[model samples]
Target: MQNQAEIQKLLVLCGTHSQTAFEQLYQQASPKLYGTAMRLLQNGELADEALQEAFVHIWHKASEYDPEKGSAFAWMATIVRYRALDIIRREKSQQNRSEAMANEQLALQQGEDFFIHELHVDEDQHLQLLQECLKALDSQQRKSVLLSYYYGYSHSEMVTRLKRPLGTIKSWIRRGMESVRECMQR
Candidate 1:
């Protein structure tokens, strides 16, 4: 767990919509939350979904954080855990659906190979746009985004490999994603 005082500060900043503070909070807290989700759900895919949903909730509800209730990390962890549990429950209720059925549905979504093979020109345009957007990001943001999304490194892994503070890595990825979205919209 991170220092309570520091977590509190970040929470305060998050309430004010400070992206840097939110990034720092995520870096400081996400591993524990992810671990909690994994433990509860026991599936990497479900854990990822829970963590993503928890973060969206956190971003929207940062202002509701109350130190009087518990440490900031604990509060965040609770959210992730609950989200994981909910997903587990939902999955359990849908257990009658076979894995083969799920796979078939997924395959159906990808059944159209036109985009993959026939639309070479459109694919080229998208690839060019992506490259241009990536180029617009700062070096740290670019590297963080690429290493995480392209190479499948977790933020914790990136912290170790990049040898930078977790908060900075989180900030880089967050800002990098925003830049990519904005650029793509253009």
Candidate 2:
């Protein structure tokens, strides 16, 4: 539903390699695509890596986008998602990350849905809401939230990685969640 003109331009540029069109397209859609990759990948580094790869793919695969099937944004999203998933599957470093994510899934099956709020995010507006809520928390609290929810780090892992006490990590998560909830409600 967005970037119809840009997509048309991209379609034209696809065959011509127009840098201006590419830059325009990147400016219009990178945030949503990056946000989607971040939510899917969890790690900021991985998300950024995915974002880079996705843009490369966009450059190469722009000709394949068929707006008749869906929006141009949707087409770009699919390419980005595929590229991100492929990176996680193909690269050794990301494969380990995938394993860690798998372990987290197993942990979730034990009825310990402490990360339940993550499941509620399903919209672009929610991302904006998250950014707003995150701004309200302290730096450490914000990092803790992003690490846990965005990166899916376990509480203990976050504590160890952050060099903070377990209690502090727990407090950060709870307070961050409370703050985000209050902000979203308002």
Candidate 3:
């Protein structure tokens, strides 16, 4: 009945490449993940495609997960989110580059509002609690998570932002998640 139980059920299906379980997980999780991708990409068709790819990746990657690493939902959510970001970067890199010269003002405004207002942050109180919890992380950990979650960057993008090695960014993200998990437990 727990989330982990549901995830374990899905992972079994995934490991064995079960069609029915794949449909079940897609039915269950893809709507929210697709909506997340749509909001980030602002392109429904692309979001739909990305959602499918993300689910496929999820199926492939599910066995690598452990409940002890994080909640099934959070781990799966990370997979969906990063997959969408990857698609956007790959397909729209040129568009993004031109925004600087083409619609700088509009892009700037929308980009600012996108992170601050469009991301559907939980609430002031919840964010305050999260921020307080995030204080446990050192600066790099905080930056990596924020860049990835708020800005929708992939792990490689995070490395570019931090000017650090990929392994370092990976370590920061994992350690930061662990720190936040511990903080929330208290």
Candidate 4:
């Protein structure tokens, strides 16, 4: 932790776009800010992301810091906390979407004949079309999409369960969905 005066001085220098001052400020404040993020997120990766995003904000908005209003550390910590909160809200939104998808899947499963009849499509033909579209995907993409939509697994959960990186899992799901959509349209 840095003394308030030193932090204030560093922030002032950062406002002038001094990289050295920004680096020093990051070194001084990151641990505490990261701790604040971790406390809010309870996930190391999310905390790291929040810390990085907060630092970027600090760098850009350093000129706005006002000693009369509050301490420099408090301002930075607030930024980190807000970023973590954003991540939490995004995760909750995704969970809600997953739940909705799961409910739709359940409805389809339970009312398959009625659903197909309502659509004026033969049940076997509709199922075969979907199966064929699924089979068109690469195995990894297929698995990722199925886990996400059918099992209501979050992207983070898929990363853990699939033993793949987050970006890769997201890409697989996205590409898989696009391919499925194109195939269904055909």
Per-prediction tally of clashes? 0, 0, 0, 0
lDDT by candidate, in order shown: 0.80, 0.75, 0.71, 0.85
Worst 10 residues of 1 by lDDT: 112-121
Candidate 1, residues 14-120, lDDT tens digits: the string is 98999999999889888888999998888999999999999999999999999888888888888898899899877764453334334533643686322223335
Model 3 ranges with Cα > 4 A deviation: 1-4, 96-186
**Order by lDDT, highest first:** 4, 1, 2, 3
Tens-digit per-residue lDDT, 32-65, candidate 4: 8899999999999999999999999989999999
Question: What CA RMSD would you report for each candidate?
Answer: 14.7, 18.1, 15.6, 6.4
Candidates 1 and 2: which is better by lDDT?
1
Per-residue lDDT of candidate 2, residues 46-126 (tens digit): 889999998888888777776667877778888789878876675655456557656655654664432343455545676
For candidate 3, the clash count comes to 0
Show the colliding residue pairs in model 1. none
- Prediction 3 TM-score vs. true: 0.46
Q: After TM-score superposition, what is the CA distance of residue 35 in candidate 2 from its true location, in Å? A: 0.5
Report the lDDT tens digits of candidate 3 across residue range 1-186.
235577667765776778788777777766777777888878888888888887878878766777677776677778778978898778776455344324433644455432324346746665556767765589788767766664467887667656899998888888898898888777
Provide the lDDT at 184 for model 4.
89
Per-prediction TM-score, please? 0.51, 0.46, 0.46, 0.62
Residue-level error in angstroms, candidate 1, position 31: 0.9
Taking all chains together, the TM-score of candidate 1 against the true structure is 0.51
